[model samples]
Target: MYEYIKNPALIHEGPPRSATSMLSKPRVPLILVHDGGGTSFSYHLLDRINRPLYGIENAKLHDGGWWDGGVPEMAAHYVSLLGKILPEGGDILLGGWSMGGLLSLEMAHQIALAAREAKSRETGESSESSGTSTPKTPIFRVLGMIFIDSIFPLRLAELVGPLPEEPIILSGEHSRTMKLKDKVDLNMTHARMMVRFWQVPRWRWRDEAVPVPPTILMRAKEFVNRNPADDQSFVDYTRDLRLLGWDDYDEEHGHFIRDLWEVNGHHFSIFDHKYLDDVTKKVRKAADKLDPPEF
Candidate 1:
């Protein structure tokens, strides 16, 4: 049980951390960028899975949007928000679930460009013309990525939808009010968003170009969509990700957060079939890989 609330403006609580400094000393912090849709309370649940096992802390950007800024001007605001989550002058691993994962990839690309510019300025060499490798001024020493039931590029329809008025969820204490009609509408909405974002430019993060950091991706098994439940069929989700330049997209793992070594699924899967244990166990194992420096 990670103690959490829906919004930061909650009643008579306590002080909040400045965006720049939410981490603790001697312990590395994980920037957990959660997806936008409903209230961010779900991340409170996500927080529980992380802090206990890793002995590290994490925080969610309330009402976060993956586009770039907020929901409206996401593309522009994305990098700056990324700066906030990154370790200030330190190597901080990036983790994203659902839409947050896609945004993390985009931000990594931006950081790469910034490094290029800084090198050019320092050495008085024109990076564009020189065509030589310049020193990398990392946005953060992004080590590895943890993907929880996400591959945004493949599922465009889910990302472009405007923030839902009411949070759309498959499993929640509040799911009692959810109706079949809403699920149908959401499916249609997801289709349009994916289609529209199709033409949007894609950014690739290469292991050769940057630090070649390691990566981790988790996919849901039993959890299928209602409409095109078989939509992800025949898709070697890992290969598609490899094309995107990530080092690994492991599917040999289980789903849910409370398992012994299973990779967690999408945000909704957190509430599916007592799966949280499975998700947590996998993430812990993936995280443990960093313990004695085993890549």
Candidate 2:
């Protein structure tokens, strides 16, 4: 059973923020994003791993107030919620499956920015206190990002225009079971936001002025080339990943590394018990390679 952690920050204004599960004493907290259905149910099997883990539920599960924002906005909400749960200015390890992976990437990027701002503020405060300049260093670090069978959706705006007014079908069993109209509205909002999310440019270190952390991409072997569109999409996505420096790995020098692991079964089916052992093994191996927390 998943132990849900409530966010005290939202005790009165909105529904409490929820975590799918949490570890008592994690080496470093690993937070996973919710899949397309906007629930962390799909990642329930990952609880078997003996690591500090938390799965973020979709904001829509609470209210429809944040339904219209793009990836940046969603990531910002998570960054705030995570700050409340994680140690202040501590290292974070993040991963996601499918669209959740893309969201995780954006969240990591946003977290780094927030960390820099906080560092700058602290440095200025220290300099004022002692009347001496203090060199600023990063307070929080995103160790790495794990991508599971995720392809960045970069053409959503062009594909889905003006935020669909019609209700989208909630295909997942978890979503289909929801009775609240607002919850269904949340799903529609996410679908529309996803169409807008692709508008956010890929993280290019030089162009975007954002740090690209090391990434581990686990692919579903059977799903990559299911159709011509899938084949082309994979090619295009991987091409950008390489261009954005997701193909480099050098553990000895502590450089950002991007590695890929091919797992059995299709995208959705890969999380089943039959394949979870192999999946968890690869996830742990990738996470272990990330920079260890400072003592």
Candidate 3:
């Protein structure tokens, strides 16, 4: 369902590269999912990472439709697309910023599930018991995951309480201003709605059957202090930055390597030009851990 867009500049000494061609390279491709804005354009600002990089955006954005599903459904859609893109299957690095980060976790889980199912079918365990043919899905080995300033959904709720109720009626001037704001930034409006409506189902790494890949969590050094009077004070938020609410899972499982890097700037500003270089550097460093050491 996701169409591969061409980026001639990203092509290195080869024909104009498509998605499949990008994955066909010797190095495992790093796929970054779009943030809440439903577009991966922001990722283009990143400096060259010395690896094949692909950004996956919401197909609905191009088709003028809306994603009416939750995080799981969205992850499933991407996993299916990845299967088609690399039918032969190979290792890949998955990551994203904010909402994309949450989606990446789910995507990794789904990929592992598919691989397990595929293996079961191979030894006649699944088919013999179920009496139904298991549809073959491409198996992918996830090298690691990079989470950019992403807070777990449960933690997010504890930090910021319930969403404020929308006023039934607004003043004429205020209504006009709201409409203008939406027009000026339609993507933001859509993103806000998508996030507000969708529910994040409970997911835990320990509950999963497959082993989780090594994870690198790049947390913002500063917390956004927009609402000073809010119940959750800045101190409480900053104190939790050590793990970014992933402490429980990590403490329990200890199956994969977990590294946390604090990057300079607040959550949103981390993507700004002033701080983006540091972010890019950290990302590249985190990704490099999965690579074979140069002798």
Best by lDDT: 3
lDDT winner, 1 or 3: 3
Those runs of model 2 whose alpha carbons end farther than 4 Å from true positions after fitting are 1-26, 62-66, 130-139, 156-163, 166-189, 195-198, 201-210, 224-257, 291-295
Error of 2 at 242 (Å): 8.5
Candidate 3, which ten residues in sequence have the lowest lDDT sum?
A: 7-16
Model 2 has a clash total of 0
182-295 per-residue lDDT for model 1 (tens digits):
533443343235324443223333333343245566665433343554554322233234322232222211211221122434335653556656665665556544322221
Q: What TM-score number comes out for model 1?
A: 0.51
Residue 9 C-alpha lDDT in model 2: 22
CA lDDT of each prediction against the hidden true structure = 0.41, 0.60, 0.65
C-alpha RMSD between model 2 and the true structure: 8.7
Summarize candidate 2's per-residue lDDT along 1-295 as a digit string, tens digits.
1223653122112112232233223356677887655666656675344446677877655343234566677777777777556545577788888767777877887777767677677778877796666553335578888888766465444434466554444444645465655563565466556545445434444334555688777777664356755534322344335322233322332444467778777766778888888887777677766644222
Per-model TM against the reference: 0.51, 0.67, 0.72
Q: Which model, 2 or 3, shows the larger lDDT?
A: 3
Candidate 2: TM-score?
A: 0.67
> Each model's number of backbone clashes?
25, 0, 0
RMSD of 1: 10.8
- Clashing residue pairs, candidate 2? none
Candidates ranked, most accurate by TM-score first: 3, 2, 1
